[model samples]
Target: MHPMLNIAVRAARAAGNLIARNIGQQDTFEVATKNKDDLVTSIDKQCEKVIVDTLLKSFRDHGIIAEEGGVQGNPDSEYQWIIDPIDGTTNFVQGIPHCAVSIALRHNGKTEIGVVFDPMANEMFTAARGSGAFLNGRRIRVGSRDSLDGAIIGTAFPTRYRDRMHAYLELFSRLISNCADVRRMGAASLDLCYVACGRFDGYLEQGLKAWDFSAGDLILREAGGIVTDFMGEPNYVKSGNVVSGNPKVLRALLQVCDVQNLPAILK
Candidate 1:
């Protein structure tokens, strides 16, 4: 593993341990609302601090873009660590074990290392730019299912982007009718990891922050999956809209979503 990737794995594990220690204490922790439905808890802040501090200790000059702490370190540096201390805060607060700690190191605008750790399951998914994706040290790959009718898809609720709900529902309805089934696991980072490991044939979502998908994006790509914006372009990280899966499933999803004709509200 690259030294930077090893650092990221260490940081992710540290933060995940912190989160696991706080499980079932949601009521004791002070919760703050970032928006109508979005939330942040003391655990989120503490985990972010742990992750950021851990990374800085090894690479003091690298920049950081974290969920709770925001940006820090040298802004002009070629390397940036993108982190989401708790990818599924709602799930965590609700006593669900679907959340994860996500960390990614981007060099010169491209992700070089990605790590997502789920403490509850003790599963660690990781990848480097050219290295293959892995789960618990075993190499993994996207699912072989190619047809939508046989594919199980993953997606998120448009809770944070109510304005685009109508467009999302339209796509959701079509997917339900066409695919074998659909799932909403509530964590974008884990959703992407699931795709990388073949847990879900394909996944899509919009209105995500950079930290939400940066780590998982690189993992999926290295696992032999395709990731792109709804327009089938490679700008999902910037557009905050992502669709990913094995090559054939991704192509099928883009055609069914008809992203090019999506409503203005979604765009």
Candidate 2:
């Protein structure tokens, strides 16, 4: 592992273990509504603190943009850690065993390393730019399905959006007609990781923050997958709206879903 990723892997595993222990242990676990569709728990905040404290302790000059906790340290630092301490909170709260700790390092505005650790399955997905992608230290790649006609795809609900529910439904229906299957698994980070590992041929989502995608996008790109926006541009890192898949299916799926006029915000 690269030195930066080595640190991320260590931090993610430590935080994931702490989170897994607290999962489903108490119905009285405190919860707060970030919004009607979004929820946050004490575990999320605590896990994020553990990760932030660990990373910042050694690299005090490094910047951090994270879920649960906001930005800290130097924003213009060459090394920035983007973190989702525990993604799949809905699954975690429900005791579904699909959540994980996701962390990444960005240097000069491009990803340098990424780590997503799923404690329940003991699976660790890691990637460093130009080094290829990995699961538990072994190589991994995107699926080889050539056609969307029989390929399984994934989607996520943008809990932050209120005006686009019906729009999403319409698009979902159109995709259902063309694709073999679609799944909405409620865990944005893990859903994208699954795409990176070839469990899903493609994944699309909107209204995501950097913490939700920074690690996943790096993993998917390193895993031989192509990721872009509906415009088919490499806008995944900038726009938050993302579409990813193996090359063949990525092209096919974009043809039906690309809304060039929707503006970058709606991408």
Q: Against the unseen true structure, what C-alpha lDDT does each candidate score?
A: 0.90, 0.84
Candidate 1 per-residue lDDT over residues 1-267, each given as its tens digit: 788889888888899998898876866797889998888999999899989889999889989998888789988899999999999998888889889999998899988999999999999999999989999999999999978987889998788778888888888888898899999998998999999999999999988899999999999999999998888898777888899999999999998898666764256
The deviation in Å at residue 2 for candidate 2 is: 0.9
Q: Which regions of candidate 1 fall more than 4 Å away from where they truly are?
A: none
Q: In candidate 2, how many Å is residue 154 off?
A: 0.9
Best by lDDT: 1
Worst 10 residues of 2 by lDDT: 258-267
lDDT of 2 at 267: 33
At residue 219, candidate 2 shows an lDDT of 93
Each candidate structure's TM-score, on Cα atoms with residue i matched to residue i, is 0.97, 0.94
**For residue 114, what is the lDDT in candidate 1?**
93
